[model samples]
Target: MRALHVITGLGVGGAEQQLRLLLRHVPAQCDVVTLTNPGPVAAGLTADGVRVIHLGMRGNRDLGALPRLTRLIRTGGYDVVHTHLYRACLYGRIAARLAGVRAVVATEHSIGDTLLEGRPLTPGVRALYLAGERLGRATVAVSPAVAERLRRWGVPGRRIRTIPNGIDAPLFAHDEVARKEARMFYGLPEDAYVVGGVGRLAPGKRFDVLVRALAELPGDVRLLLVGDGPEQETLRRTARALGVADRVVLTGERPYLPDPGDDAPGVVALLSAMDVLASPSAEEAFGLAVVEALAAGLPVLYASCPAVEDLPPDAAPGALRVTGGAGAYARELLRLRAAGPGGREAPQAVRRYDIAYSARKLMDVYTAALAGSTLEVSSP
Candidate 1:
């Protein structure tokens, strides 16, 4: 299959990194086109031997980009055009249709009750979304909750496909040697209990809550924050105000999945060094980091994870649902600390969300779109 993927930006966010990882496993001649902001992931894609093109879009309302994208798609001879994120989907769908490509697919990676791609959803946004959705053959929701959200937004049930995100479970398997090395590299005490949070540091992510919660914990307990965004300074100031500045370690953004043989410890070693993972985001299309932490045998506290809630409760035994806020997080951290549930066995969710399996499922969706049909499967 020859596929062309159009995404809003190629930054180091979850959706962007997921695209890079999925392409490594997809067995198709795939190319990427970033409408704007072709950052690190674009380079990574090119390094992986995939052709990448920058569309040079100036801004959201840049109508000039439409014609350029359409001309590219028209000349690319692609069997399928897949779009990701909100802005890309809106423009990519229209461009694909204008270019006479019938097999168009879009993945709705983040659609919450009142947010799309971490921004407020206005009536104008909804109108454009619906209009573009009509042009595509299918819209893939990362979780059943997201799929239901699409249905509530009036997208036809037949056009909605529920395909959850996936991860490489064994790649994150816990390692005691890595734990020591990561701790040594970060100057953390060997006996200290580490609490970790991983994601873009945005206001909606509620990482400030984690910072405040750190102040309430014992002096020996430490918090490790992963990823980077505009809220980094705000989080640091909050920690300083609460006198817990020394207890927080911000590693900035690391690769979502890194090569294992590299000298530096990737996300895998960081997970091994932590005692638990906490995600305080109140809204999410799918809780990807929660699944990766489960694969690492770490207990998790998540505010809203459709990824776990969509499955049977028994699927992720190490995961616990909690409300968002500093007080709530502080109380839960203390409670879990007292419980002292040591490293656990990888849960059933690990195997269920393997990245290899997800790539195969996506290829199935691509095949169906090309055939002008729907791929049916059992759903809850």
Candidate 2:
């Protein structure tokens, strides 16, 4: 079947990366289309030979592009239109139906409740999202937490399916040589304890908490911040004010490493080099970096949030939570450090959520949508 994976933008984030993985592994031939101008994600998709269409949406409320989108979808003749994130689902789902696509699905990547710090849903935006969601044949959630939150927002439970986010575990396996190489590439001391955090530098991620916690650590401890967003400047200022600017490394929006060919191991090398992975976000539906770090046999310390608590504790001894502030995070870090690196169990806990498995589950949803099967499967 010819499928189209739609998203807001081709940025460096979980939904886009997961889309890339799906394109790489799904059995059916697929194309990727974006509602905004293409960036990092579009480049990645292009490299993988996935066709991409950019709708050039300027802002969140810009539906003026709908007619263009409708024509594109109709001409593309997609059998399945699987959308990611909010804006893409809102516009793409409706357009897909208008274009006579047989199957339209959405994967709720984050819990909508936590999306805006528990703010009440805006009337207009909520109405728009729900209206489009109603048009979709099926909805998939990356976590049960995400699914329940959506259902509570008035989406029918029978129309929603829970499919966990996945990681390419073997891709994140521990590699000694690659780890050493990556450390050297970054000019990091081989013996220094490295704590890494990867995500958008935004308020919901609460990266400030991580910086404060890192400031409380010893001088030998290094903090690596990966990716970029609106909060980049604020976070940098926070680091300086905490007197730990020197210890923090902000690698802003680096290109994701190419496939883990024999020549160079990819992103997992950076994970392997880290002594511990910190995901101190205030909100998350499912943390991809946490699972990836666990797959590399590294420990993870996350904030005590609803979505984070859903992580499989049996997979890693270190998937523990800390309070939301800096002091609590510092104390938790000390506890984790005493436990030592690789203290977390092997990440066999994530086997069911591996990329290949999630891809198969998504395809099943697509098939059911196309076949007009409204019966939801019991929790897998």
Candidate 3:
């Protein structure tokens, strides 16, 4: 079936990268619409033969984007309209209905207990979310935890589908050659104990903890912050203040899937170069970065990870949930560094979150939407 995927922006992010990856296996014709900031991922989608349209949404209050998006959807002849992120969900669902599309689906990529897309979950935000939610047939939560959050926020159980975020497991598998190449590409010494953190360089991600933790460790220990955001300067400043500036490497942003022959290494290669991955973010819809790190056989330390927490302990043997601030991380880092570096085999969690399985599950959601049975969704 022909479908259109609407997202707030196409920057290098978990949800953005996941969308690009899932489409490789999704069994239908698909196009994309980015409300604003059609960055690298949009280019990646286009390179992969998917048509991409930028709506040029000026800001949240740009009402003109509404009519423009509606016209695009109306003329696209799409059988299903899938939206991602907060702003797109709010606007895309309304536009899909107005465009006469019956099958509308949204994926709640980030809806924390106290935040929705990094904004505070105020009464106004919740109210508007529920109101716009009524316009869609289903909301695909990235994990059971997020599904539960939506249900608690008054989204009916039948309208929420728990489809966890997935990854191309083998693509991230550890490789000795890749490890050497990646370390050289990033200018990281092979002997340095690299502590990697992958995600937006945002306050909520708590990357500062890793920097502060680095200050307490030896000079040979390095911190690698992946992805980019407004907090980039803040993180750099924190590292410099703590006297670990020279050892910190902010790789800007790396794509999960890179175009053929791209000079820069993709996330898979970068994962190979790392000794361990740490996610100190307390709020996570799904610990995608943690899973990817596990897929790379790198040990994972997370503050919160529904992807691992929802599963049994054995599912992700390398992942450990840590608490407290930089001191807590510093202790863990010292223990891990002392133990030395060696990647484990990809665990059961990696097999469970396979992208192909997720693709088929998503197809089921799309099939149900098209067949007018969205209300029959079952919990995962």
Global lDDT of each candidate: 0.89, 0.77, 0.90
Model 3 global lDDT (CA atoms, 0 to 1):
0.90
Give the per-residue lDDT digits (tens) of candidate 3, residues 161-234: 98888888888878888778878988899888899999998889989999999999888988888889989999
Over all chains combined, what TM-score does candidate 1 have? 0.96
The clash count for each model shown is 0, 0, 0
Q: Which residue window of length 10 is worst by lDDT in model 1?
A: 256-265
Order the candidate numbers by TM-score, best to worst: 3, 1, 2
Q: Which stretches of candidate 1 lie over 4 Å from their true place?
A: 257-264, 375-380
Q: Pick by lDDT: which candidate is best?
A: 3
The residue-by-residue lDDT of candidate 1 on 1-380, one tens digit each, is 88999999998888998899899999999999999999878988998999999999999999999999999999999999999999899899999999999899999998899988788989989998998899999888888999999999999998888878888788888889989998998888999989999899988888898899888899999999988899999999999999999999998877745555545556778999899999999999998989889989999999999988977768888889997588899999999999986756798767878778788888888888988996553342
The alpha-carbon deviation from the true structure for residue 123 of candidate 2, after best TM-score superposition, in angstroms, is: 3.8
Error of 2 at 22 (Å): 1.0
Model 2: ten consecutive residues of lowest lDDT: 258-267
TM-score for candidate 2, residues paired by index: 0.92
